[model samples]
Target: MRVFLGITGASGAPYAARLLAALVDAGCEVGVSASAAGYEVLATELYGDASLPHDEVRDRLVGGLDGVTVYAGNDYSAPYASGSAKVDGYVVCPCSMATLGTLASGAMDNLVHRAASVALKEGRKLVLMPRETPLSAIHLEGMLRLRQAGAVILFLAPGFYHEPKTIDDLVDFVVARALDQLGLDQTLVRRWGQ
Candidate 1:
């Protein structure tokens, strides 16, 4: 599968990292784009620094991962900017409310938003993993608008029925769900009746 992953300025870097690793392991061609604030958040949360350069941050995030390409957030010329690229799915892990509103408003001002718009217009699978908590009415309305537009509004809420043991386990639970939405089978977490 060809997938486009967008990282926005939201909490849950672990979810984004795990999802990318899972996508590569699943043999999917993945394209990635991260906003400026997204880079800083990843650096601080995952790498213990907030001043990492863009290239370095990208390197560290997808360093040893294969089948992944990183694009500038504002690069409107990327293949994902158009529906003709045949991208099977697009996911915005840790999707920020700002990004959500942009997409809901039908304003493709950046590569991430453009890719999502393409996915929606092409009737492709678009999964949005928003990690925000206590969503406001505006947030809920935006999510509803996206859902009505045929996007999967998957919240980053991990289920505890799997009995997670650590933070990584919790992250895996959410990433596993996202993978399932992409039609990727994973043994990261046990099934309900397995």
Candidate 2:
């Protein structure tokens, strides 16, 4: 399967990273894109460097995955831009409010949003892992709009039923749920009956 993974400026960078790793490990071809704010979030929250280069950012974001291709968020000419690209699914892990708003409104200003829009138009799976908390009415409305438009709005709300002992475990829970939605095998987090 070919999956397009988009990372935005939300707080759950780890979730995006782990999801990419899991997708590659599952033998799926992956295409990745990180938004401008996504780079800011990675530098501020994950790497502690405000001026990290794009290649360094990509290296840090996708440290463990192999055979995965990374694309610029602004590259609208990428293969995933067209519905004929034959991608099985698209995921916006750590989706931000701005990105969500764009997707909800059918705005394709960038490759990430365009790929997501293409997925929706093509009737393929499109999952969004929004990580914001204390959501306002506007955020909820945006999410509703996207959901009604056939997008799976997977908020990065982790469950404690698995007895997570660290931040990584919590992030994995969300990523695992995303993988489950994609019909991929994952051990990133435990299932309910396990």
Q: Largest TM-score belongs to which candidate?
A: 1
**lDDT of each residue in 93-116, candidate 2, tens digit only:** 889999998888888778899999
Query: In model 2, how large is the Cα lDDT of residue 75?
Result: 82
Residue 28's lDDT within candidate 1 is 98
TM-score of each: 0.98, 0.95
List per-candidate RMSD values in Å: 0.8, 1.3
Ten contiguous residues with the weakest lDDT in model 2: 185-194
Per-residue lDDT value at 116 in model 2: 92
Give the poorly placed runs of model 2, Cα more than 4 Å off. Answer: none
Model 2: which residue pairs collide? none
| Backbone clash total, candidate 2 | 0
